[model samples]
Structures are given as C-alpha cells and as structure tokens.
Target chain A: MRFGVVRFPGSNCEQDIVIACRYLGIDVDYVWHGDTDITGFDAIVLPGGFSYGDYIRTGAVARFSPVMGEVVRFAERGGPVLGVCNGFQILTEAHMLPGAMLRNRGLKFICETVPLRLERTVCQWVDLPEGTVVRIPINHNEGNFTADAETLARLDANGQVVLSYCEPDGTRAPGGSAPNGSANDIAGICNERGNVFGLMPHPERVVDPEASGTDGQPFLTTIVARLAGV
Target chain B: MARYEIFVTYKQGIFDPPGATAERALANLGYDEIESVKIGKYIRVEVADGPNERARVAEMCDKLLANPVIEEYRIVDAEGAVSAR
Candidate 1:
C-alpha cells in the first residue's frame, strides 16, 4: 500500500516514517503541507513534530494548512489516516478526533517508551488482539489528552479508545505507568468511523530492531495487509 | 485601526500544569495566603474598525486565537472596556 506522509514546515519525523515504510516494503511519498493534492495515495500518515513551532497551541496553526483541506476531505470519504504524536494533536485540532492535548501534569517534556495496551481492535491501524501490551516510545511536551466526561463516555461507548497506557502484564495504569498523565491513561484513539486513528506514541521509531524493537511493525503491516485484502 | 487585547485561559474544569507549578512555587516561597494561580495567554490584535468588528473579533477567537473546546477567551478594547468574553 502506498502511504502519503505529510510534511509540514516543522515536521521532523517524515523521514523516519518514510524509512520505516520502505523497510516494510510499502511505497511512500512526502506530501507537502501547502499542497492540496493527495491523489493516488492509499492512506495518509501525519508524522510527529512541532509544526509551526506549536504556536498558539499544538497543531492549531497546522490545521489551517492548505493540504489539510484535502486531507479532511479524504478522511470524510473514509480514507485511512494515521496520526502520530504531533500528528495526533493536529487531528484533534482539525476535529477529525475528539479531545485536546494538554501539557504534561509535571510541567515537563517527557521522552520515553511506555507500555500501551490494545484496548480495542476495531481500527484499521491496530490488528492486535485485545489486551495485548506493546512498548512504544512517546516524545512530547503536550501529550496529556483530556476531554469532557460526556465526550469520554461517548468515546468509550463507541469503542474508540483504541490504546491505553498499561503495565507489562496489561493492567491499567492509573498514575504510575502513565507517562504524561493522559486522561484514563489513553495513548491513542480512533474516530467514530474508525478510519482516522491518532496516537501519542511513535510507532515508526520502533520498527527497526537495532534502534528499539519491532513492536511497531504490526501498526504498519496491518495497513499493508488491509490494502492487500489479505 | 483599533487594538483588541485577548486573554486565553484553560476552562474551569480543565487542568493547567504550568499554573499548578507556579502555585506550588509560590507556596514553597511561603505565600500560603494565595488562594489560586492560573496562567493564561495574552494576545494583542489590531484590526480596522467597522460595523462588524466585534463579531469579527469573536469569530477570530473561536476559529484561531483560542480553542473553545478547552479554553475561554476574553477581549478588551484599547480603552480597557470589556468587549467580549
């Protein structure tokens, strides 16, 4: 499957995602933020970075990029889209996903690998069985996800809470295991339609065993398999 | 052109990490009498005065200057008159 990796002015992870995709034998292309055309791409991936220097708010300015209009239209048509880290922030800002990312509770930037439990397998990006725990690295200053009680309830009821921070044994981590103090220990989620997925962790960073591990391979391979109808 | 000062802050129920850290720092400095501390953003915008200026400012806040989902913004005219909140 061919993936379109979006490149905003400040996007730094586009190259990493491209390398990871190439390693998995998936064709990838870099889509500029100012370009409105995303034709011929099977899926879209918004890589992580401090777009527009995270000015005003994280992903707030980047959401207004010209390419986003096309991306929004693509998502509305049920196109598969995966947003990682700041990409997740952009998705929320674009209203493609619910909730907002707040600053870490300790007022510090955190970068580390944390265990994430696959809470639901309804999304295209996550094909793991329920309750599977995988360690993925998260790097961000504003990764604490929050939403109103009503929205949280709706997300839970719709099975949109796709990933949550948990212990190695798959126990939900209320305070200790959660690195950024995300609400309900949420690390990722999908929209109601399940075509758009957003996660705070960097799955692309772990696709190489020498760098970290291959725990992230499934996230990319799942898309390949889906597009191939395997 | 008229200048508008906008103040953006987290909603009442939302968490403010920097504000909380500042509050703790104040407490550590023996300022126990302080009730609370909330940090927010102050933005200055200049726009031409027109019939729809007030509405335009509100639209800007809603669309770009502030995120209505987790933040509340207040606007003040140059003369310090409360314009919109």
Candidate 2:
C-alpha cells in the first residue's frame, strides 16, 4: 500500500516516516502542507515535529493549512490516517480526535523510551492483541492529554482508547504509568469510526533493528495486513 | 476601524503547570499573600468596523485563536468594553 507523509514548514520527522515506509517496501510520497490533493495515497501519516514552529500552540497553526482541508475529507471518507507525536497534536487540534494537549505536569520536555500497552480495540493501525507492552520512544513538551470526564468515559466505554501508558511489566499504576501525567494514562486514542488513530509514541524511531528494535514493525505493516486480510 | 483584544485562558479545572510553578516561585520570594498565578495569551486584532465584525472576531476565536475544548476566550472592543465571551 502507498502512504503519504505531510511536510509542514517546521516538520522534522517527515524523512523518518519516509525511511520507515521505504524499509517496509511501501511506496510513499511527501504531501506538502499547502498541497490540497492526496488522490493516490492509500493512507496518510502526519509525522512528528514543530509544525509552523509550533506557534500559537502545538498543531494550532498547522490545522488550517490547505492540505488539512483535504486530510479532513480523506478521513471523513474512511481513509486510514495515522498521526504520530506532533501529528497527533495536529489531529486533536483539527477535531479529528477528541480532547487536547497540555504541558507536561512537570513542565519539562521529556525524551525517553516508555512502555505502552496496546488495548484490544477497533483501531486500524496496530493489529496487536490486548495488553501487549511495546517499547516506544516519546519526545515532546506537550504530551499531556486532557479531555472532559464525560468524553473520557465515552472513549473508555466505546473502546476508543486504543493505547495507554503502562509499567514495564504491563501493569497500571497511579501516576507512574504516564510520563506526562496524561489523563487515564492515555497514550493513544481513535475516533468512533476507528479509521483514524493518533498516538504520542514514535514508532518510526524504532523500526530499524540497528537503531533500536523492530518492535514497531506491526504498527506500520498492520494496515496492509488488515486490508489485504493476510 | 474596530480593534478587538482577546484574552485566552485555560478553562477552570485545567491544570496550569507554568502558572503553578510561578505561583510557587513568587511565594518563595516572600510574596505570601499571592494565592495563585494563571498564565494565558493576549491577542489583538483590527478589522473594518461593520455590523458583522463582532460575529467575525468571535468566529476567529472559535476557529483559531482559542481551543474551546480546553480554553475560553473573551473579546474586548476598542472602548475596552467586554464585547463577547
């Protein structure tokens, strides 16, 4: 399957997504933030980085970019869209995902590899089973997730929360799981339709065994597997 | 011309980390009377005066200047009167 990676002015992770896609034998193209058409790509990946220099707020400015108008249409059409890190922030700002981001409770920019547990849900990106703990890296200042209590409950009840921070041994603990103090330890979530997924961890950073480990392979390959029914 | 000033602040119950940090710092500096400190953004916009200008500025806040989910915005007209919330 082909993938499209959006390149906003300040995006720094577009190349990483490209390399990851290429390593997996997936044909990909760079979709500029200003470009409005994404007719050929099977899926879209909003990579990480400080888009629009993260001015006003993270993902706030990039949300109105010309290409996002098309991204919204693509997602509304049931196209699978994956937003990683800053891309996730953009998705939230664009209202494709519910809730918003806040500064880390500690008010620090965190850069570390954290343990995340994948929940059994309708998310189309990762095909892994419930409670699978994977090591992924997160680097950001505003990764704390915030949503109203009602929204959180709805997400929980609907299985829209596809991933959450967990201990290394795959257990939940108070205030220990979330590195950023995200509400309910949420690390990733999906919309009601489950076609769009947004997560804070950078799977592309771990795809190369030499660089780290192949623990992230499923996240990128599962789309093909699910669609092709392999 | 109609000039509007917007005050964007996080909604109540949303933790303000920077605000809390500063509050503590100020208290440590002997300002014991200060109860809290909240941080927010202040933006100013100028548009041609018209009947729909008020609605347009509010629309800008709803769409861009503020995220209504986590924050609220207040618009003040050039006369410094609170125009809309």
Candidate 3:
C-alpha cells in the first residue's frame, strides 16, 4: 500500500516515517503542506515535528494548511489515517480526534522509551491481541493529554481509547504509567469510526532492529497486510 | 484600526505544568508564601474598526486564537477593558 506522509513547514519527522515505510517495502511519498491532492495514496500519515513552529499552540496553525483539507476529506470517507506525536496533536486540533495535549507534567521535554498496552479493538492501524505490550519511544514537551470527564467517559465506553502507557510486563501503572501525565494513562486513541488513529509515541523510530527495536514493525506492517488482504 | 491584547490560559481543571513548576521553584528559593502560579500566552492583534469587530474577535478566539477545549481567553481593549469568555 502507498502511504503519503505530510510535510508541513517545521515538520522534522516526515523523513523518519518515509525511511520506516521504505524499510517495510511500502511505497511512500512526501505530500507537501501546500499541495491538496492526496487521492493517489492509500493511507496518509501526519508525522511528528513542531509544525508551523507550533505557533499559537501545537498543531493549531498546521491544521489550517492546504493539505489538511484533503486529509480531512479522505478521513471522512473512512480512509485510514495515522498521526504520530505532533501529528496526533494536529489531528486533535483538526477535530479528527478528541481532546488536547497539555505540557508534560514535569514541565520538561521527555524523551524515552515507554511501554504501551494495546486495546483490543478492530482498528485498521493495529491488529495486536488485547493487552499486548510494546516498547515505543516518546519525545515531546507537550504530550500530556486532557479532555473533559464526559468526553473521557465516552471514549472509554466506545473503545476509542486505543493505547495506554503500561508497565513492561503489561500491567497498568496507577498515577505513574504516563510519563507526561496523560489522562487515564492514554497514549493513543482512535476516532469512533476507527478509521483515524493518533498516538504520542514514535512507532517509526523503532521499526529497525539495527538502530532500535522492531516492536514498531507491526504498526506499519499491519496496514500493509490489511490492505493486501494477507 | 483598533489594537487588542488577548490572554489565553489553561482552564481550571487542566493541568498547568510550567505554572506548577514555577510555583515550586519559587518555594525552593524561600518564597514559601506563594499560593499558586499559572502560565499562559499573550497575543496582540490589530484589526480594522467595524461595527462587529468585537464579535469578530470573539469568533477568532473560538476558531483559532484559543482552544476552547482546554483554554480560556480574555480580550483586552486598548483602554484596558477586559472581556472574558
């Protein structure tokens, strides 16, 4: 499957996503922020970075980019869209996902590998069994996720909470699992329709075993496998 | 043209890490009497004067200037009149 990785001004992780896709043998190309056509791609990825210099707020300015119009349109038609880190922020800003990211609870930019437990939901981005733990790197200053209590409840009830920070042995850590103090230890979520997914962790950075671990390989390969009906 | 200043801050329930950290730092430096500290953003905009300019600014706040989901913003007129939502 062909993946389109968007590159907004100040976006730094687009190349990393491209490299990961290349390693996965998936056809990929860069979609400039100014361009609007994304019809040729099977799925789209909004990679991590300080888009538009994170002006006003993270992802606020980037959401208005010309390319996002098409991305929104594509997502409406039930097309798969994955947003990583800042991309996740952009998705939330674009209203494709719920909630907003706050600054890390420690008032510091955190960069480290953390364990994530996948929720058992039939989403296009993940097909892992329930409660599978995978180690992924999270790097950001504003990764603390917050939402109203009502919205949080709705997400929980609908199975929209797709991933949560967890212990290495796959146990949930109360109060301390989330390095950034995300609400409910949520590391990732999906739209109610499940076509759109957003997460704070960097799955692409861990796709190569030589440089990093291969725990992230399944994230990309799952899409390819589903598309190819393998 | 009218100049306006906007102050955007996290809502009451949302966590303000920088603000909390600053509060701690101040206490560490022997200012233990401080109750709280909050961090926020200040923005200035110059807009053409019109009958509906105030309404327009409010719209701007809702649409882009501030995220209503987690932040509250106040608009200050040049004369220091504050309007909050």
Q: Which candidate achieves the best DockQ against the true structure?
A: 1
After superposition, the stretches of candidate 3 with alpha carbons farther than 4 Å from their true spots are: none
Q: After superposition, how far is residue A41 of candidate 3 from its true place, in Å?
A: 0.8
Per-residue accuracy of model 3 over A1-230 as CA lDDT, tens digit each: 79999999999999999999999899999999999888899999999999999988999999999999999999999889999999999999999999999988887899999999998665688989989999999999999999999999989988898889999998887656898999999999999988899999999999989999899988888988887898
TM-score of B-chain for each predicted structure, in order:
0.93, 0.93, 0.95
**Candidate 2, residues A49-160: lDDT per residue as tens digits?**
9999988889999999999999999999999999999999999999999999999988999999999999878888877889999999999999999999999999998889
Deviation (Å) of A24 in candidate 2 = 1.3
lDDT of 1: 0.91
Report residue A19 deviation for candidate 3 (angstroms): 1.1
Q: Give fnat, all candidates.
A: 0.73, 0.68, 0.82
Q: What TM-score against the true fold does each predicted structure earn?
A: 0.97, 0.97, 0.96
TM-score (C-alpha, index-matched) for candidate 2: 0.97
Task: Give model 1's docking category.
Answer: high
Task: Give the residue spans of candidate 1 off by over 4 A.
Answer: A174-176
Taking every candidate in turn, the Cα RMSD to the unseen true structure, in Å, is 1.1, 1.2, 1.3
